[model samples]
Target: MSVNVIILNGVSSSGKTTLAKAIQKYSHEIWLHVAMDSFIAMLPDGREFDREWFPMVEVSREGEVLPQMTNGPSGEALLLEMRRLVRGLSETGFNVIVDEVAEADTIADYRGRLGNGCLVVKVDAPLSELERRERERGDRLIGLAREQSERVHNGISYDLEVDTHAQTPDALARLILERIAA
Candidate 1:
């Protein structure tokens, strides 16, 4: 049987991963969470040291702030790699939940590569709520908020759109399940 691929896409701190995990926990579907952040984090030393992927961040150590590496690879490259993984997983009969900031073009490209059975869900929240979540998540976004807003408007349309600002994970998961069933 072919897997039901779901792309839980949204701006940063939109709770994509949280909701994706909830669906995986509640549903009987054989699913995999292909997190871009974890993918970037696991690169080998040679690739990890490359300036193109691993950028330096000024991190706090005691009273001092020092540079550290964060956000490996450009967003485009990361999304492409994620599409490749999704295609592989779907071919192997595993439903894939991709929690990434995939652009409209990337989504279109991936849809072609993964075939028509894929479901794209756009998880969104109020900008203010998203900002608070971002702060709470401890991912120093810097200028990403502005970029996220712009991309959300421009990104490809989704099969489902959920405003997760006030709903619990279970509620959101139910919404997703209902859509998938429909």
Candidate 2:
């Protein structure tokens, strides 16, 4: 079977993971859910991900262009690895559902490195609504929101935009399926 890589990106509380789960549930193919954040969190040695480290390594003098690393791992090491995993999975004929921030730099990296045969899905929610959800979910949601806000403000683009502000996960999944069909 030809691999279909589904990428989910968006602001915090955007329901990317939720959408990924829905896709896995509805898709007839053997879909694999790969989450960069979850993989990084699973890293051994009990090392917590340093959120502020990117702006440090990736910041530039012009402010016009925040620098991005081309070296191993770059500022977004986990994401880079996730992209690599996607490439490998595609090569192996596995349908992959990737959930990440999908920031501009990473998207460029993916385009340059991963080639074609993939779908980019962007999930979005109002900042205020996201913030409220963040406050409600506490640490996990708050951290996710912080990363998502930074990514979106930094200017990220996608092939499909899914707004999950009021829709159920199943509804969002149906929308994504229809988009993919189109």
The digit string of per-residue lDDT tens for model 1 on 42-128 reads 777557546667565565545655444444456347657778878987887777888876677777887898776688888888878
Off by over 4 Å in 1: 1-3, 44-51, 54-78, 153-155
Model 2 weakest lDDT span, ten residues long: 64-73
Best by TM-score: 1
What pairs collide in candidate 2?
none
Per-residue C-alpha lDDT of model 2 across residues 132-179, encoded as one tens digit per residue: 887886654344464446545366556777778878889988887777
The Cα local distance difference test for each model comes to 0.73, 0.67
Leading candidate by lDDT: 1
Find the 10 residues in a row with the least total lDDT in model 1: 64-73
